[model samples]
Target: MKIRAAVLHSIGAERPFQDTRPLVIEELELDPPGDNEVLVQIKAAGLCHSDLSVIDGNRPRPVPMALGHEAAGIVKAVGSGVRDLKEGDHVVAVFVPSCGHCSPCAEGRPALCEPAAKTNNAGTLVSGEHRLHRDDGTPVNHHLGVSAFADHAVVSRDSLVRIDPALPFHHAALFGCAVLTGVGAVINSANIKAGQTVAVIGLGGVGLNSVLGAMVAGASEVIAFDLDDSKLALATELGASHAFNSKDPDCVEKIKALTKGGVDCAIEMAGSEKALEFAYLITRRGGTTVTGGLAHPEKKVAIQQVSLVAEERTLKGSYVGSCVPVRDVARYVSLFQQGKLPVDKLLTHTLTLDQINEGFERLAAGEAVRQVIEFN
Candidate 1:
């Protein structure tokens, strides 16, 4: 089948992406679902930092690749051996496709599924197949096994989680990445207890969700930090008890004083080594610092090694928020339905596929919270 998709031929393109135009909208051929796979007609796809990381060359992957991973759609067809989901079922695409037999999957950590990681890095489906190609037969790699920037995609069933058909596609799309990563970091990784003081660093879509998650987890204080005052205001409106500009020279001191030596759990979603360092600094003694950000592979953070021993501090890296997508997606969606999560507030813009580059520019400029490309 022919599909209109955003294809990135290279990485590290100059900013003002609207002018450099890293993502070229191209017509490509999509293959049918193979065994244990499903064909989905994408309804909505969110522009996320993970996608931006690829565009900026922070996270390198094989190209030309069809980009876009955070998405929701309807299952149009199911391949052989896929009995759980049927045509017309609404679903969210998970970037990591867990093979149940893998060590991580067997241990109940599907996010670290070895096969998924290998296939993802290789830019192929979990089954090791390339379903997208140019008219000239040049293969286009799949982005996180989703390639969701296109109208339709063929993905492994493991990459999908069935959702309530009543959920809005645009809202549901967030559950795939941002909501899962942000909220999951607090609930699963940090495991914030009632009355625990929490600090959320970076107020992008994911960081804001961390703020909301802290509230849901019954945190006594949800302090928000970001370079953008507008994002700080939005985070405050969403339930953060205090907001601070991380760029403030007194930012760390103020937070430490406010919490009497820092928060119980500090979550870093900013995808910067500096942000991770800030999160570490803001964690109280014996507290946890969880980072879900995807910084460049070459980037590293400097931390006093003795702090781990003296303060009994725990620094953990969370991927997909340490989420069991099947469980967490449903849990988060339930929270959204009950009006507790308020995931809708994170969505600030909706654009057609043609406006994708502009939407990305807004994201890159920190001008939008969460932008979704809505498909008819």
Candidate 2:
């Protein structure tokens, strides 16, 4: 089948992306679903920083690849051996496709499925197949096994979680990445107890979700940190007890004073080594610091090694918010439906596929929270 898709031929494109035009919209051929796979007609896809990382060369992947991973769509067809889902089912696409037999999957950590790690790095489906190609017969890699920046995509069933058909596609798209990563970090990773003090460093879509998660988890004090005052204000409006500018030289000092030493759990979602350092600094003795950001592979943070031993500080890296997508997606969506999560506030903009570059420019500029491309 022929599909219109955004294809990135290379990495490290110069910004303004609107001018450099890194992702070329091309007509590509999409193959039929194979065993344990599904053909989906994409309904909505979100522009996230994870996608931006690839464009800016922070997280490198094989190109020319069809980009866009955070999405929701309608299953149009199911492949052989796929019995649980069928046409007309609404679903969200998960970036990592877990093979149930893998060690991580067997241990109830599907986000770290070994086969998924290998296939994602290789830019192929969990089955290690390339389903996209240029008109000239050149293969285009799949982005996180989703390649959802198109009208249609063929993905492994493991990459999809069926959702309630009543949910709006634009809202459902966020559950795939931002909501899962941000909210999951607080609930699943940090496991903040009632009355615990929590600090969130970064106020992007994911960071804001962490703020909301802190509220849902009954944190006594939900502190928000970000360089953008607008984001800080938004975080406060969303239930943060206090907001601070990370760029303020006295930022750490103010937070420490406010919490009488620091927060119980500090979550870093800014995808910067500096942000991770800030999160660590704002964690009180014996507190936890969870980072779900994806910095460049070459980037590293400097921390006092002895702090771990002396203070009993716990620093943990969370991927997909340490989420079990099948379980968390449903749980989070239920929270959304009940108005406890209030994720709808995060949807700030909606664009057509043609406006994708402009949407990305807004994302890079920190002008938008969650922007979704709505398809008809």
Candidate 3:
């Protein structure tokens, strides 16, 4: 079948991405689903910072790749041996496709699936093949095994999770990444409990969700930090007990004073070493610092080694919010349905695929929370 998709040929091109046109819409041929794979018609896909990282070359990937990992769609067909799901089921794409046989997968940690990581880095499906091609017979790489920027995609059966058909497609799309990564970080990684004080640094889409997560978890004080005032304002509206601009020289000192030394849990959602370091500093003695941000592969943070032993400080890196998509996605979606998590408030705009570059520009400028490409 032929489908229209966005293809990124190279990385680190001069920005004003609309000018460089980093991702160009191209019509490509899609192969039928192989065994244990499924063909999907994408209904909605979110433009996330992870995608931007590839465009800016902060997170490197094999190019000539069709890029879009956070999405929801309808399963159009199932390949041989697929039994749990069939055609017509609504599904969300999980960037990490787990093969149940792997050690991490068996340990209930599919987010750390070794095979999935290898294939993702290699730009192929778990089956180790490209299912898309250009008109001239050139192979196109898959983006985290999803390649959902296109109207249609073929992905591993392990890469998808069925969702309630009643949920709006755009809303369901976020569960695939932003909501999962943000909320999961607080609950799974930090194990945030009621009455605890929490601080979230970098209030992007994911960061804001972390704010919501802390509030929902019954944290006593939820402090939000970001460079943008608008985002800070939005965070306040979404149940943050306090909000502050991270750029203020007094911000860190203010947080410590307010929380009395520091917060119990501090989350870093901005993919910067400085932000991670700030998250660490704002965490009190014996507290935890959780980072869900994807910094440059080569970047590293410096922390006082003695503090780990003296203060019993804990630092953890959260990938996909340390989630098992099969279970967590359902739990989070149920929470959203019950009104405990008002994730819909995060959807600031909806754009067509043609407007994708502009949407990314807004994301880069911290002007949008969550923007979706709503297919007609």
Candidate 4:
């Protein structure tokens, strides 16, 4: 089928996103899914931090790649042998799929699945090739195996999650990555229980959801920390019990006081070494400190060996919140439909594909909450 797609030709070493400078938006031929694959027609796409990572050289995935991994739409076709899904079903594409046979998935850790995990790094089709090409049949880079930036994309059946048709397209898109990771971090990774005190650092899309997850999981005190007052307000609206300025004079001290010593868990979403340390400092003995942000390669988080020993704290790194897309995406959709997920107010910006650069600019400037690209 012929569809519209933004083709990235070459990314500059200084800035991978700058590679879109020679961007081309035209008709492209989408290869039909082979057995074990499914084709989807993207209705809404969210411009997320991971997508930004690839463009800004933070997460390099070769040149000439299609971007936008956070997206939702409808299944247009299913390859032979795919039994669970059918054409015309609403679905969200999981950028990372769980191949049940992989070591991590088989071990109950889908987040670290090796075979599917290596695709983004390899920059090859699941079968080790590209599924998209120019009208003239020239090959282009595939951003992640399931590139939702295009109006239509082919993905492994394992990567497609069926969602309710009652869910709004844009809201459904956020669940594809950002919301899932943040919420899953709280519910799945931390398993935060009632009355436990928790801190969410960095109130972006991920951090805010972490705060919501804490509220839902019954945290006694959900402290939200961020440099922006606007985001702090949003966090409060989303159920944070307390708010702290990221630059407050006594932010750490105040968090410690509120929890009567330290919080039970600290979720670091800013991806900065300093921010992670601040969260680490305010965690009580035997508490857990989780790194939820995707920090750039140039950035590093340093941990004090003494703190680990003296506090008996557990520091864990979570990827996409240890989610099993087939299971988690549907649950999130139900949450959104029942208004358990405060999505309508959380997503704050909309633009077209032509304005994607501006959307990313707002993301870099910290000027937007969640910017989405609308295709009509």
Candidate 5:
């Protein structure tokens, strides 16, 4: 079937994405789902920074690839050998589709499943097949096993988690990435205890979710930092106890003085080495610094080697918030349903497929929080 999708032919396109028009919408032919695969009719898809990274050349991937990852949809059909799901079921797209028998999966860390990473980097499904083709018969690469920028997708059964049909597609879509990564970092990676002081750097969708997660964990002080004051204000309104401008020359000192040293846990959601450095510096002695950001592959952070030993400071990297989607997605959704995780506040704008270029422009400018493309 021919379906409309946003495809990126090259990386590092000029900014003001609407002008350069990096993502070109095209009607591509989608093949039926293979064995153990499910065909999803994408309902809502979020414009995540990961997608922006590809446009700005911060992250590189195969060209002619469908570009959205975080999304929610309905199972239009299921391929042979699929038993747990059926047509009409609602599901969220998980970027990493773990092969249940991988070493990481056995260790309860599907986020790091080796095969998932391999296929993701290769721009194919776990079955190592391309299910999309251009009208010219050229294969289009899948993004993180879910080319959800399209109206439809054929993904591995392992790449989806069923959600309550009552949940709104736009809100449920965020759980696939932003909510999972941000909340997972707090609950799973940090295991933050009540009364702990936490600081989150970079107030985008992921950072704000981290603020909510810290509040849910009972953190007494949730410090929010960002270069943008509007984002800081939004963070404060959500749950951050304090908001600081990361651009301030005295910002680090302010956080240190406020916490009487530093925060118990510091999270960096901005995909920058400098943000990671700030997160590390604002962590208290014996505290943990967690980075959920995805910096360029060649970028590296320079940390004081002695601090890890002397202060017992732990600098850890979090992928998909170290989440087990089948479990975490439902738990987070339950929290959302109970009004504990006010993720709805993060939804700043909704656009149609035609307006997606501008949505990305807003995202690139830090002018929007979580923007979703709602299909007809």
Candidate 6:
């Protein structure tokens, strides 16, 4: 079938342009689903930082890959023996899918499922073949199995998270990645108790959601830190009790004073070493710091083992908020439906597949919180 996609033939350095670039939206074709998979007609997709990292050249990716991970859509067709789901189910596509019998999945940690590397990152499904292709029948590798940048995608049934009929497609797409990462950081990884003081460094898509998660978890105080004043204000609206501009000279002092020495939990959503350092330093004795962001591979972290041992502090690195996507995605959708999670406010703008290059420019300009690509 003919489909429009933001195809990347080469890694983007800065931003995508509409002027005859092969790295942005070079229209392509899509194939039908095979065994244990389903064909989805994508309705909406969320722009995520992970996608940006590739374009910025921070995260190197394979060429000729269709870029998009967070998405929600309707089932257009289901492959053989797919009994649990059928056509017309409103669902959000998860980037990771557990084989259920794999070593990691059997151990109850599907987040570490090895199939993720081969299926999503490598753009080949379990059958060792790709779904989408050019009209001339050349392979255009699928990105993350759910290349929602296109009008349709063929993905594993395990990657599909069915949601309630009440949730909006655009908002539900965010739950697929951002909400899961942020809330999972608090509830799953940290297991934060009530009345604890929390500090969140970085107030972008993931960080703001972490602040929201802290509020929902009944934390006594949620201190938000960000370089952008607009994001600081957005953090407050989302649930932060306080906001701090890290660009200011007294940012660290303000954070220290607010916590009466330091906070009980510090979550670093920024992938920078400096932010990770601050997250550790601002934590009191026995406090925990969780770094959930994906940093460049060559980046090194500096730490004083003495301080960690002497203060009895713990540091953690999290992926996708340590989530089991099937369970977590539904919970997030319910929260949105119940009016507890104001996901709509997190949206800054929406663009089309053709305009994705421009959207990246706006993201670099810090003009929007997220720029979603509507795959209608």
| TM-score, every prediction | 0.99, 0.99, 0.99, 0.94, 0.99, 0.95
State candidate 2's TM-score. Answer: 0.99
Q: What lDDT tens digits, residue by residue, belong to model 6 across residues 236-278? A: 8787888888777776777788788789999999878889988
Residue ranges of candidate 5 with Cα displaced over 4 Å: none
Q: Compute the lDDT for candidate 4.
A: 0.80
Q: lDDT of each structure?
A: 0.94, 0.94, 0.94, 0.80, 0.95, 0.81
The sequence of per-residue lDDT tens digits that candidate 1 reaches over residues 1-376 is 9999999999998889888889999999998999999999999999999899899898999999999999999999999999999999999999998898988899998989999999999999999999999888889999999999999999999999999999999999999999999999999989899999999989999999999999999999999999999999999889899999998999888999999999999999999999999999989999999999888988999999999999999999899988999999999999999999999999999999988888888899999999999999
Q: Which pairs of residues have clashing backbones in candidate 3? A: none
Regions more than 4 Å wrong, model 3: none
> Runs in model 1 with CA error above 4 Å?
none
Off by over 4 Å in 6: 16-23
How many clashing residue pairs, candidate 6?
A: 0
Better of 3 and 5 by lDDT: 5
Worst 10 residues of 2 by lDDT: 129-138
Q: Residue 7: error of model 3 in Å?
A: 0.4
RMSD versus native structure for model 5: 0.7
In model 6, pairs of residues that clash are none
User: In candidate 2, which residue pairs get closer than 3 Å at backbone N, Cα or C atoms, i.e. clash?
Assistant: none
Encode model 5's per-residue lDDT on 214-281: one tens digit a residue: 99999999999999999999998997889999899998898899999999999999989999999999
- What tens digits encode model 2's per-residue C-alpha lDDT throughout 344-365? 9999999998888888999999
The CA lDDT at 341 in model 4 is: 75
- Among all windows of 10 consecutive residues in model 4, the one with the lowest summed lDDT is 11-20
